[model samples]
Target: MSDKKLALVTGASRGIGFAIAERLIADGYRVVGTATSEAGAESLQTKLREHGDEHSALVLNISDSEQTEAALKALLSEYGTPFVVVNNAGITRDNLFLRLNEDDWNAVVNTNLTGVFRVCKALAKAMLKQKAGSIVNISSIIGTTGNGGQANYAAAKAGLEGFSRSLAQEIASRNITVNCVAPGFIQTDMTDVLPETQKEAILASIPGKRFGHVDDIAGAVAFLASEDARYITGQTIHVNGGMNMG
Candidate 1:
């Protein structure tokens, strides 16, 4: 096995996932980031190459069971097993409950919640054998606070948290930790398109009065994945800038 620690980050082509991958690499791990398309994967590879050749990217569609299995199997065969797994790949199909269709619900739930389940399942056996690992699932503030047009998203994120907690309990004895980092409205592609009026409204509601940088969430994830947080499991560290303090 390589002496360097390995980290697997899903949906890391851009936004929060990309930031987490960058942060983990900076923290001294060889990172493998996943993107849905070849182009995106190439972009991640170029960005991460600055760290080292072992820090690279892969093409993975988490919603597809066959692809998920194959990609993960290939990774395991080549890199042994990742010490850290970050489930950050997700899709948004925002619609009011009354207007939401079955496809919207299925797409969001399948990709966000079930996708994480699949990835975790694929990697769990290796983690069990290693007797050490960290799994951080990226959750959303909408999961707890709820939202007007994001019932599907909220449900999916909320399910991810529950899944993380249960998995944490099951793996705790083996020194494997499962936790969640729930981000509020961080500045990303999803939030960047908001109209100025809507953006102002959101800013006014937040106690910080400013949008959070991607690095804010990345920092929280990096901490949870480190040895310092070995005792902390089955919990969520919210990085929401006081949007919904509880």
Candidate 2:
């Protein structure tokens, strides 16, 4: 369309991913966002249209290698390679570490860590060929400061940072930058599902005295994806309302 930079946001039907897509579109990128289901794709399309925007949506289940490969092929063939890739699809199965089942741990690692790897691996060649790209991986504060009930989630997310760091080093010569956004207690559908007591307890630990808005994370992400952050690489920008700082 505009020849402006393109951004692809995974799991963008709602929450932080939705916010990032909206921000990028407003800034004039032709964005393509992904969701897991046909219904989710349709809903995301409707929402984007209501914004009177030009962004598109696709059904992508990143944990499924076949589905991810097919989706990437279709995206590149139709929409062209994205100048920016946001790996944001993730799920959490929280329980005490001793009570965590193998299935639960595997699912978290597969979706959060393996999924990001799949996207980056599939797209690296195109990005290197283009001689420029931005990769913003969505991580969590728990990744750096592990939480008691989120061992699996924390491990996957933490591994994502290490992955990004290594990948950044490898791609820096090609002018591609890789970074992560570690968000804490962002007000999203996921957080809304928490019990009131749990929510209140979370708020109590935040020195900023409130939960972060999705837009807060979105703004930070857009900035990192922009030309302004061209000189930055292998870093994680935290948006946690002072919940965890390291």
Which candidate leads in TM-score? 1
Which residue pairs show backbone clashes in model 1? none
Cα misplacement distance, residue 212 of candidate 1 (Å):
0.6
| lDDT of residue 48 for candidate 2 | 80
What do the candidate models score in CA lDDT, each in turn? 0.94, 0.91
Give the runs in model 1 whose Cα sits over 4 Å from its true position.
Answer: none
Worst 10 residues of 1 by lDDT: 48-57
Local accuracy of candidate 2 as per-residue lDDT tens digits, 54-131: 678999998898889889988888888889999999998999999999999999999999999999988888889999
Candidate 1 RMSD to the correct structure:
0.9
TM-scores of all predicted structures: 0.98, 0.96
